[model samples]
Target: MRITKIRATPVAVPYRTDETWAFGSRSGMVSVLVELDTDEGIVGLGEAAAYPSAEIVLSVLKSVERLVVGADPFRIEQLIQRIDVVGTWHHVKATSPAIAAVEAACWDIVGKACGQPLVNLFGGRFRDSVEFFYYVAAPDPDTVKAEGTRATAAGFTTCYLKVGSDSLDIDIERVAALRDGIGPHMNIRIDANEAWTAGTALRAVRAMLPYGLELVEQPVSGRNLQQLAYVRGRMDVPMLANEACWTRYDQLSVIHNGAADVLSVDNQMDGGLLNLKRSAGLCAAAGMTVLKHSLGELGVALAAATHVIAATPNFRHANQAYGALLSDDIVDGFGGGVDNYRDGCLDVPTGPGIGVALDPDRVARYARLYREHGDTEFSFQHPRALTTGLALPKH
Candidate 1:
């Protein structure tokens, strides 16, 4: 069936707490929810984490309308090709989330038409449930410890915390607290988000070694693979690449450089679910493991990625999610808070298509929230960032 219409809604869902990273902080998630209507009366759902901004994503959707409308939903690859090559979106990496949303919606339509779940269509279930890490927002040592304790008590095996504070001493203290709170059994993973130089990364990682890190993520800039390799070679803890590997081309470079022990892949960043699977295969061929990265997504996006992750092997590490931080979700009953997780894993939805439907009430509520406060409150550009500027290579 042909796609008849594309409906895009930007929503703002509040976080339980502000998600603070090295660059800035955001109080919640801003996502452009997409609904594709087909001639057969089938509707498909997709979600795009308003990476960069909602304005850009909305503009992208508008620009691709001619290319997407009247397209066959089942022919995802060809449709995406038109959006990429014909629409000239291939040259713009920032347009990925919008393009990915459309592609995901098409996949949802295909799954519904075939009366199959996306996991079955992709490769069937290699796993029944996918594991996700508990995100512990870095605020202070006490808060980090408390979040760690909560994560451990919730039966989460891995606890992820953001490092690269203004001082390495503070990072060390926070890591120490997380270790102390989680005790010796659980794993603690830290992401620096490309905030350090090679020398600083080496020094910083070495200092935190006593606390026992499971992995260090993008301690140095993703642009310089050699620097990443330098830091990775000196460290015992495995290095996980993030910014360095946004696409398959980037993944190839990382593999060639031997820059990381693990690669972070995002369907939104790369293109769509198919590309995400392709990314896993690329890494698998290189004898490397990959994990799904998040730009902060809600249930719709989370469920879409879950289907792909379930059907794929070699996703050995617990993937990233905003469940710990998301106060609520627009979807009915999937992937909002820690309560939805059992032993830190989300059960694969058995329903046709993506298997989760949006809650109209919640959607309207969050949509109103988006209209009222999305720019100032939900924005990634923290006021502190505007004033102080980004301090890289914090020594």
Candidate 2:
């Protein structure tokens, strides 16, 4: 069926707690949701990790919204290429949230057309569920211990602690205390957010080695692949490439160059679900693994990531966090809900088309923050009245 309309709305959702990483302290999250309408009464949905100042996301949507409003949603790959060609003409950001929005919306429509989850349509399933790692926001040893204890008590078995922002000695003490509090059985990973240099990364990894850390993410700056390789070669635990890598090209550079042991693929930041799958294949080809990266994505992208990781044998557990941590969302916050995570594992959603639906009321409420009090919310009227010219016969 031909796509008849494309609309994008930005929303502001407060965070449950201020998450402090090397980047900065985040008090709220900004996201853009895309809705695609088709001739055959189908609606596709997508979400992106939006920042207030991200001109790319805004421009990408504004540029493509009207053009795709009368095209065939079923031809998703072709549509993506059209986006690329247009982006080349305009020279917008490569991985804009708007691109992610359109891609995700196309997936939603395609999944619904096939009566499958997005992953099943892509390659079928290799896993039924994915495990989550808790990101504890603490700056000191005591706070780290307390947060780790709370997470453990809440049944989270894998936890990600932020490092590389404080002094080496403070980070060492925090890691030691967290590992001790979580017990030896719990898996602990650390995210530096590209704050450390090669020397500091080596030193920090060495100091934290005895705690049985699962991985150290973005240990060194993203730009210096040589230094990343140097640190990766010397580190006791696997070095996870987060910000340093995004696409198949990036993954290949790291793998062939021996810069990383594991690749963290953030679907939103990298491109979209399809790009993430490509990155996973590249990593698998190089005898490496993929960890679904996090970029403060909402439930739509999280659900997509779950399906993608579950379908790929080469992908390990995803770094899907924030659902339980975000105070607001379009869909019911998938994780952090009672059944969202149980015993460290999350059950795959069984509903069709990414297994989630947006809350129109919440969408309306949050859209006001970005647009006129009522202008940005996606209403049934918008999709219902979309004029889809004759194309393929309605199913």
Every candidate's lDDT: 0.92, 0.73
Q: TM-score, each model?
A: 0.98, 0.88
Model 2 / residue 261 / CA error / Å:
0.4
What is the C-alpha lDDT profile of model 1 across 304-383, one tens digit per residue?
A: 99999999999999999999999999886677799999999999988889999999999999999999999877977657
In candidate 2, what are the lDDT values of residues 279-320, reduced to their tens digit? 888888888887887767667777877877778898775465
Residue pairs whose backbone atoms clash in candidate 1: none
Model 2 / residue 125 / CA error / Å: 1.9
Candidate RMSDs in order: 0.9, 9.9
